[model samples]
Target: MRARTLLTWANGTTLAGLAIARATGATIRPGRDGVLIAEGYTRRIPKNTCFTVGSVIFTRRTAEWLLADERTDLFGHESRHVGQYAALGPLFWPAYYLFCGYSYAMTGSYGCRNALEKHAGLHAGGYDPDHPLRPWAARFRRRRSENG
Candidate 1:
C-alpha cells in the first residue's frame, strides 16, 4: 500500500468504506493508482451515481462505465477524493457532509459552493461547474456593471 493509502486505513476510513461495500454487495476490485473500485452498489439512499469514501469509490453502474473514455473525467474527479480522504482521514466524512449542506443552502446545489467538490472539479463529477451562489453571482455582476 502507498503511504497515503496506509494513512486512510490507519485512520479507519478505508476500513469503513470496505465494510459499506461489503454490506452493499458491490463487486470490489483493484483500480488504477491506490484506489479501490466498488461497483453495482445496491443502495439508493445516496442518489448519486458515484461517490467516494477514503480510497474506495462506489458506483451504481459497472466499473467499466467509469473507465470508459467519455467518463475518464469522472474517474479523475473521484481519485481526487481519495487524496482528500488521505489528508483528512475520518474527519473527511463530517467535513464533507457539512460542506454539502452549506453548499445546498447557498446555491441550491450541493456541489456548487462545496470546497471539496470544487477542488475535485464539479464538471468532472457531473455537477454544474458554473453554477454559483445566486447572491454572490448577482453581487459580482452588479459590481462589474458599476465599474464599467
Candidate 2:
C-alpha cells in the first residue's frame, strides 16, 4: 500500500478511537487531491476550525480546506500538524491543548506561544502573535510597564 494511505489509516484509527473524527453522522471522504476530509459533527467546534489527526483532517466546514489544487500557506501550516500527529500519535491532542492553554496564558492568544503553531508559521495559519491582549493580560502588562 502507498505510504500516504498507511499514514491516513493510522491517523484515522487514532482519531476514531479518540472520537475526534468519525463522530456520528459525519461525512468522510477522500478529496479530489487525495486529502481525507471529515465533517458534519454535532459538536460545537468553532467555524472555520480545522484540525488534523495524522493525515486526516477534521473540519466543521469542508470549504475550510487549506489544500486544494496547490498548497497554500494554510496548507503548509496544517501540514506541520499532520507531521506532529504522526510523531506524537495519540498524545498529540492532549499535548496540543496543553500548549494551547499555555499560549493563552502567556500571550492572550492560543497560538502566540504554542510551539507547534510557531513551527507551522502562526501567521501562515491566519493567527496574529501580537493579537490584542485579554483583559487580565492587558492589566498585567500595564502593571509591569508602570513598575518599570
Candidate 3:
C-alpha cells in the first residue's frame, strides 16, 4: 500500500541498502533470499527492501558506510521501506512470500517481489527487480461464472 516498488539484494553485496537505511532512519536486519527489505525501494533494487516480517533494521557494517558515503536518494528509499514495514507489521512477510512463491512457480518469475530491493545493490552493480521470471504464473482473477 505505501510502497510502489521493492528493493531486493543478495547477501555479500555492498552495503548501499544498509547505508540508505541508517541515513533515512530505518531499521535493518538480515532477511531471507536477500540481505535487507525496506517498505519501499529506490529504482535500483526495487523488490527486496520490503521488510514484510519485521521492522526495517540495518546491519552494523552498512550503517557505518552510509554515515561515511552520504547518499541522500538511496537513504530516502530505505527509509520509505521502514515505514512500509511499520504499516504492514508481521502479516506482510508471510503474505508477501506466499504470493512471491506462487508468482514464481506459476510464471517462473518473481512478480510478487516487494518494492524495496530494486535499488538494493546500487553500490556494486544493482538488482533487476524484474530479473527473475516465474513461468506458469496464476492468472489474475476478477470473478467467476456460476455454471459453465
Candidate 4:
C-alpha cells in the first residue's frame, strides 16, 4: 500500500524469514487496518508471546486478538515496530539485538529497558512502562535472599 508498508514487508521477509516460517499453521492475512496478522502459532511458540516482523504480527491465538478489547492497543504498539523496521532497514535486527542485550544487562529484563520497546510503549504490549531498571547482580541477591 504505502511506501513505508512496502519497506516493512521487505525488511521483514529478508531479516525474519525463520520467524515467519516458525509460525506455521497460523492463518496469515492482511488486516483491514493496514497490518498483516498471523495467528495460531502456539504449536511453534509460547502462548501469549507475540512477535512482529515488520508489519506482520504473529500470535498464538487469533481468538484472543479478536475478542480482547485491550489488544487494540497492541496493534498500535506493533505498528511502531514496523515503522522501526522501515527506518532501520537491514540494520534493524542487529540493532534490536544490541538493544536487547543492553536492556538485559541494565535491568535484568530485556523489554523493560530496551529503547525500541520503550519507544513503542511497553504498556501497550502488556509490560510495565515505568519499571525500575535493576542491576544484573541485584537479581542474584534477590534470589539468594528469597532462599535464605
Candidate 5:
C-alpha cells in the first residue's frame, strides 16, 4: 500500500469505517484502486445511498449497483473522498459534519453547500450540481447583493 493509504489506517479512520461496515451487516470486498467496498449497509437514517470513509466506501445498495456502468462517476466521486479522508485523517469527520450543517443552513440540504461534496463533484455523488439555496438564504443573498 502507498503512504496515503497507510496514513488512513494509521489515523484509524479506515478501521472505523470497517467497523461501521461490519456493524451494519455490510459485505466487505476489495475494489479497484486499493479501495474497499462495503455493501448492504442496513441503516436508513443517513439517507445517502453511498458514503466513503478513508479507503472504504459504504453503500446501502449492492457493490454491483454502486459500480454499475452509468454510476461510474458515482464511484469516482466516492473514490475522491478516500483521498480526502487520507488528507484530513480523523479530522475529516468533524469537518464533514460542519460542512453538512453549513449546507443544511444555506440550502436546506446537507450536500448542497458542503465544500467536501462540492470538491468531490456533486453530480457524481447523486446530488444536484446546482442546487438552489433555501428561500431565506436567497433573500439574504439578494439583500447582500443590494447592499453591496
Candidate 6:
C-alpha cells in the first residue's frame, strides 16, 4: 500500500537530496509501489543490506567505499541501503545477503551493522554526504509506525 503523502497527484518529486543521489546516481521517481527499481526483472536484489531505499550491489571500489574511512566517493554505506530499498521492496532482507561482506559490519555492539546504519555511516563518514534525515523517504526496510 502506498502512503498518502508519497502520492501528491503526481508520479515524481524533486527535492534537495543531492549528495546521496549525485554520487550513487539514484533518483527519486513516483509510484504506488514506492521507490521503483530499474534495470532488473526481479523485485529484490540477490544480498544483505541495512536499508531498503537504494540498490546495494557494489564493486570492489564501492565495497571499499563502504568499508573504508576515506571521503573520495560519496554515499558510502547508507546510500547503498537506499539502493537496496529502491531495488528490492518486500525482499530486502533476503536480498541483503547479497552484500557479500556486510554481515560482519552489522554484528557488532558499537556501530551500525544494519543496512540503514551502514548507509548512514557511509554517507556520514569523514563528511556529511547527505542530509541528516531523508524526510521524503518512506520507511523503506521497515513498515510505517501508523500501520503497526
Best by TM-score: 5
C-alpha root-mean-square deviation, candidate 6: 16.6
TM-score of each predicted structure versus truth:
0.87, 0.67, 0.39, 0.75, 0.91, 0.22
In TM-score terms, candidate 2 sits at: 0.67
Judge candidate 5 at residue 141 and give its lDDT: 98
Candidate number that wins on TM-score, 3 or 5: 5
lDDT of 1 by residue, 1-148 (tens): 3877888888888898999999889988888878899999979778889999888999999888877899889999998998899999988989999999988877789887899999999988989977767797668778989998
Local distance difference test values of all predictions, in order:
0.88, 0.65, 0.40, 0.69, 0.88, 0.35
Q: What would you estimate as the lDDT of candidate 2?
A: 0.65
- When 4 and 5 are scored with TM-score, the better candidate is 5
- Any runs in candidate 3 off by more than 4 Å, and if so which? 1-56, 68-74, 106-112, 115-126, 135-148
Better of 1 and 6 by lDDT: 1
Best by lDDT: 5
Off by over 4 Å in 6: 1-75, 97-148
Q: In candidate 3, what are the lDDT values of residues 32-97, reduced to their tens digit? A: 323244322333433433322232334333444433355444545444444444454444456556
Q: Evaluate model 5: give its TM-score.
A: 0.91
> Which residues of candidate 4, in runs, are more than 4 Å off?
12-23, 43-48, 63-68, 135-148
- The TM-score measured for candidate 1 stands at 0.87
Clashes of each: 0, 0, 58, 0, 0, 31
Candidate 1, residue 33: how far the Cα is off, in Å: 0.3
| Model 2 alpha-carbon drift over 4 Å, by segment | 1-19, 32-34, 40-42, 46-48, 63-66, 69-71, 132-148
Over 1-148, each residue of candidate 5 has an lDDT whose tens digit, in order, gives 3766788888998999999988888999888777899998889867888899889999888888887898899999998898899899999999999999999999888897999999999888878868889899999999999999
**Candidate 1 weakest ten by summed lDDT:** 129-138
Ten-residue stretch with the least lDDT total in model 4: 14-23
Candidate 6's residue-wise lDDT over 107-148, tens digit each? 322223434445546434332334232232334324556666
